[model samples]
Structure formats: C-alpha cells, structure tokens
Target: MVHKEVADHIRSWRFIVLLALIVLTFITSMYVSLRNIKPAVSNISDPDHLFLYLKLLTTTDNTIPPFHVFISFLGPLLGISLGFDAINAEKNNGTLIRLMAQPVYRDNLLLSKFTGAMVIIATLFISLCLLMLGGGLLLTGVRIEPQELLRIATFIVFTIVYVSFWLALAILLSIQFKQAATSALTAIGVWLFFTVFYPIVVNLVIRAFLPDPSFLSRDEIAGYNEMILNILRVAPGQLYADATTTLLMPSVRSLGPLTMEQLAGAIPTPLPFKESLLIVWPQVSGLLAATVVCFAFSYYLFMRREIRS
Candidate 1:
C-alpha cells in the first residue's frame, strides 16, 4: 500500500509542479548565496560567519530570501498538497470503499498512506540537501566541515518533522470534509492563517498586554519580553523559524529574552551542536507534539468513519 501510494504521488501532476517550484527556489537562492558569499564573508567580522556552508542557507542578497525561508513557506504547502485529498478523493472515486472491502485493516490502510507521504518528504529533502551541498562545493570551492554537514542534516530532519505536522492536519481535514476541494482549500486556509495572519493577530493581542518600559523595572521588562516571546512561539511558524535558525546559524545563543547578567560574560561564539539542540529542544518538542496530536486525531476519526461512495 505504501509503495503504491509513493508511486502515485511521484506520478501526480501536483508533485511535479511542487518539485519544479522547490528546485527553482534552490537554484535562485543558492546562486544568490554563492555570488555574494565572498564579499559578505570578507566584510562580516562575526565569529560564526566562518561557517561558509551554513551561510549558503542563511544568507540573503536583499532580493530573494535564503533557502531556509523558502522551505518554511513551501514546506507546508507541499505537505498539504500531498495529504489534502488523501482520504476524501479516494472516497469520491470509490477507491476507499474498494480498498476497505479487501482483507486489509483500516488502520493499516490509513497509516500506510501517512508513511508513504513521509517517505517521499524525507527522500525529497535528503536529495535536495545533497544536491545543494554539491552545488555549494562546486560554486564556492570550499570543503564542508563535519559539524557544518551535521548541522545541515539536522536542519533537514527538523524540516521533515515541521512539515509532517501540516501533513497530518491536511489529512485530518480530508477526513472531515467529503469534497477534496473543500479539504484542500481548508488546509490552505489554515496554512495562510498561521503563515500570514496568525503572527499579526498574536502580536496585536500581545501589545494589549505589553508592559510599559517606562513603568516596569529592568527585570520586569525582561520578564515581559520573555512572556511575549513565549506567546509568539505558540505559532508553528515561529517555532520552526526559531528551531531551524538555531540549527543552521550557530551564533544564535538564545531563543528567548535574556537579562544583561545572562549576557555579561558571554562571548560571541558559535555554540556547540549539543548546546544548540538544547536551546531549541522545547520548540522541537512542541512541533513533535503537534504532529502526534493531529495524526492521532485523524487516525481516530478515520478508524470510526463509514466508507461510502
């Protein structure tokens, strides 16, 4: 079942279009990164700027956003396209009824499709990373350090996890809505909400409660900033941006507000990989929890659903 689903996705027109967009983005962003890297590197005195390979992902030329930014926006759309019709379209075409009529268990059927989508996502990203690295090597003539490679690999894995949460949500919508179009639009609507409007809405709400710096003590102002940061982190986009940035750019020392005392003796150096992971563990955990919740809810709904034409 997983194999069949994988093959179908590869052959689907949606997959082909999304793949083109992703590759195009890769070319554009990397070209910009490679073209300007030398001058940018020469000018910047930041210690972490020594990670030239990482800059391939994090650098921007004031035209296109970097590779990571493209992924953050496109990743959810890819997941949604693959999953928004996973159940409903099959049902509309009578495939779900026919498949359920077989000896296969519903659990196996549903879970297999999810696994297939994930397999495709993982493969797509791993291949893209390798391709990007090869291109970076050719263009820059720089040897990738072991740690830089590991950080890129970690960033890819986090991206998969981040995207899977959207996939699960799309699947849940598919099961909820009978029409595939309805599911797809609803999923896209959710995506736009989080990606575009949710942050604005959250910020407006936070401003209502924002402590005035004039009245608040220094520690109190710091505490308010920390609280506001946590509120913003509730959006998956924020969580993903924070996590991926920490992974790709090692100079990010903290995910939240820190007091002057916390920064008093701190040196501006790239964090150890272990420390970087530790800093973003909460964001990682939040993403995983969201994925699990959405997938589990969809599984429950799917298991009890009555298959019909």
Candidate 2:
C-alpha cells in the first residue's frame, strides 16, 4: 500500500513542478555561492580547514538568498501540495470508501499515505544535498570534512521534520474540508498568515503595548528583546530560522541577547557540533511537537469520520 502511494506521488504532475522549482532555486543559490566563495577562500590560510563545504550551503552574494532560505519558504508548499489531497480526492472519487471496504485498515491506509509523502520529500531533499556537495567539491576542490557532513546531516533531518509538520497540518485540513481545493487553499492561507502577516501584526501589537527599548536600562533591554523573540518564535518560520541559523552558522553562540560579562572573554570561533544542537534544541522540539500534534489530530479525525459508499 505504501509502495503504491509512493508511486502515485512520484508520478503526479505536482511533484514535477515542485522538483523543478526547488532545483532551480538550488542552482541559483549555488551559483551565487560559487561566485562569492573564491574571495572568501583566498582570504583564509587553510581553505579546506573546517566548515569549508558548508560555505556552499550558507554562502550568499547579497542579492540572492542562500540555499536554506529558499527551503524555508518553499518547503511548506511542497508538503501542503502532497498532503492537501491525500484523503479528500480519493473520497470524492468514491475510491477511499471502497478501499476501506477491502482488507486494509483505516490506520494502515492513513499511515501509508503519510509515509509515502514523507519518503518522496526525504528523497528529494537528500538528492539535492548530495548534488550540492558533489558540485561544490568539483568546482572548488574542497573536501567535505567530517564535521561538515554531520552538520549537513543534522540540518537535513531538522528540515524534514519541519516540512513534515506542514504535511501533517495539511493532512488535518484535508480531513476536515470535504473538497481538495478547500483543503489546499486553507493550508496555503495558514502558511501565508504565519509567513507574511503575522510578523507585521506582532510588531504593531508590541509597539502599542510595550515601552520603547531604547529608553530602558541595559538589563531591561535584554529582557525586552527576549520577550519579543519568544513571541515571534510562536510562528513556525521563526522557530525554523532559529534552529537552522544555529545549525548552519556555528559561530552563532547564543540565540538571545548576551551581556557584556558573557561576551567579555568570548572567542570568535565556531562552536562544537553538540553545542550547536544544544543551543537550538528547544526550537527543534517545538517543530517536532507541532508535527506530532497535527498528525495526532488528523489521525483521530479520520478514524472517527464516517465515509459512505
């Protein structure tokens, strides 16, 4: 059942469009990185010393956004596209009720759909990462260090979870809305609200309620920034940005404001991989919790839903 669902997803035109868009964005980012990388590499004494290969993923030429930024924007779209029709289309066409009439259980069917979509999403991302690594190696001759690979692997896993949260949310929408179009639009609407309007609304609310930080003492300003940041992190994009920024940029020591005392003897160097993960663990957990909650709700709704032949 999972295999059949996977094949169906792979054969869909929507998958083709997603692949094209992602690959185009990847190539554009890669080109920008390659163009700006030579100068950066020449400036360093040891070009391939540490996270050199990561430069391909994190490096940017100002005008074009880096690779992960593109993923943050487009990844949800891919998830929503795959899951928005997971149940409704089949039910609308009279196939879902019939399929349930057969030997397969409802839980198995839903799990298969989720797994199949995730498999395709995972495969596409892994392929792109490999392509980036290979292309970067060929062009710059910078060997990928062990730490770089670990960081990339961790980044890929976090991304898959982040995207899966959207998928689960989309599936929940699909279960609630009878029409596939309604579910798809609803999912996209939620995405747009969080992505575009939420930040503006947050700023307006904060300005109206909170005092100006410039007038506050140093300790008060730190508290103020942390408060705003916690509010912003409610949005999934902010959570993702926080986690990914920590993962990709090892030099980022803290997510929040640091005091003069804390920065007094701080060295300007990359953090250990485990330390990076520790710093962003909360954001990662938030994404994971969101994904699980969305999936659980969808599962319950589908199990209790009444479908007629």
Candidate 3:
C-alpha cells in the first residue's frame, strides 16, 4: 500500500509543480549565495573557515535570501499540496471504500498514506541537500568539516520534522472534510495566516497591551521583547525558523533577548554542533509534538469517521 501511494504521488502533477518550484528557488538562492561568498572567503583566514560550507548554504546575497529561508517558506506548501487530498480524494473516487473492503486495516491504510508522503518528502529534501552541498563545494572549493556535516545533517532532520507537521495537519483536515477543495483551501488559509499575517497580528496585540514602549524601563522593555518572541514561537513557522537559524548559523547563542550581563565575556565564535543542537532542542521538540498531535488526531478521527461512497 505504501509503495502504491508513493508511486501515485510521484506521478501526480501537484508533486511535479511543487518539486519544480523548490528546485528553482534552491538553484536561484545558491547562485546568489555563491556570488557573494567569494569576497567573504577572501577576507577570512583558512583556520577560521570552519563550517564555511554550511554558511554558504544559508548566507543570503543582495537579492536572494538563503536556501534554508526558501525551505522554511515553501516547505509547508509542499506538505499541504501532497496531503490536502490524501484520503478525501480516495473517497471522492470511491477508492477508500473499496480499499477498506480488502484485507487491509483502516489504520494501516491511513498510516500508509502518511508514511508514503513522508518518504517522498525525505527523499526530496535529502537529494536537494546533497545537490546544494555539491554546488557549494564546486563553487567555493571549501571542504566540509565533520562538525559542519553533523550540523547539516541535523538541519535536514529538523526540516523533515517541521514539514511533517504540516503534512499531518493537512491529513487531519483531509479526514475531517469530505471535499478535497475544502481541505485544500483550509490548509492554505491556515498556512497563510501563520506565515504572513500571524506576525502582524502579534505585533498589533502586543502594542495594544503594552501601549508605549518609551514609558517602560530597560528591563521592562527586554521583558516585553522576550514575551513577544515567545508568543511568535507558538507558530510552527517561527519554531522552524528559530531552529534553522540556530543550526545553520552557530553564532546564534540564544533564541530570546539576551541582556548585557548575558553577553558579557561571550566569545564571538560559532558553537560546536552539540551546542547548536542543545540550543534548538526545544524548538525541535515543539515541532515533533505538533506533528504527533496532528497525526494522532487524524488517526482517531479517521478511525471513527463513517466511510461511504
């Protein structure tokens, strides 16, 4: 069943379009990053070039943002596109009923759909990462260090989990809504809200509550900023962004606002791979929890849902 679903996704036009857009964005970002990397590399010493390859993968040029930025933006779209119709389309075509009639369990069927989608997504991301690494190596001639490779590997895993959360959400929507169009639009609307409008809305709410920032003390202002950052982290997009930023740019030491005392005696150097992971572990856990909750809800609802042609 998993194999069949995987093949179906591969042949689908939606998959084709999503893959094309991602590949195009990645190539464009890499091209722009490579162009600006030369000057930066020339200024840095050889010994200090640790994780330079990783930097190339994520450094933004004048026009284009980093490749990981593109991933953070488009990853949800890929998930939503693949999963919005997973079960509803089966039911629409009268296949869900037929498939359920076979010896296969309903749980297995739903799991197959999710697993198949995950497999495809993982393969696509791994391939893209390898491609980006190759391109970075060829263009910059910087060798990837062991620590850099570990960080990149962790980034890929985090990305998969982050995208899987959307995939699970779309699957849950697909189970709840009988119409494919309804599920698709609802998924896209949720994505747009979290990605584009959520930050604006957050700022407005924070302003309404805090009124004037000038009236607040330094410590109070720092508290407010920390509170706002925490509120934004509730969104999965923000969590992914924070995690990727920490992972890709090891120079990032904290996710929240840091005070002068906290910054005192801090070395201006990239963190080791383990330290980077420790910094983003909470974000990673959040993404994992979100994914599990969505999938569990879908599984429960799917099992209880009345199936009819």
Q: Which candidate number has the best lDDT?
A: 1
TM-score of each: 0.97, 0.96, 0.96
Better of 2 and 3 by TM-score: 2
- What overall lDDT, based on C-alpha atoms, would model 2 receive against the true structure? 0.89
What ranges in model 2 sit over 4 Å off?
43-50
Residue-wise lDDT of candidate 1 within 69-144, one digit each (tens)? 9999999999999999999988998888889889999889889889999999999999989998998888778899
Between prediction 1 and prediction 3, which has the larger lDDT?
1
Model 3 lDDT per residue over 1-309, tens place? 999989999999989999999999988887777777766556554333456777677666557778888888899999998899998999999988899889999899989999999999999999988998888778667677888888888889999998999999999999999999999999999999999999999999887988587788778888999999999998999999999988888778889888888888977787777888898999999999999999999999999999974
RMSD of every prediction: 1.3, 1.8, 1.8
* Colliding pairs, model 3: none
Global lDDT of each model? 0.90, 0.89, 0.88
Error of 1 at 34 (Å): 0.1
- Cα deviation in Å at residue 32, candidate 3? 1.0
TM-score of 2: 0.96
lDDT at 159 for candidate 2?
91
Worst 10 residues of 3 by lDDT: 41-50
Which pairs in model 1 have colliding backbones?
Answer: none
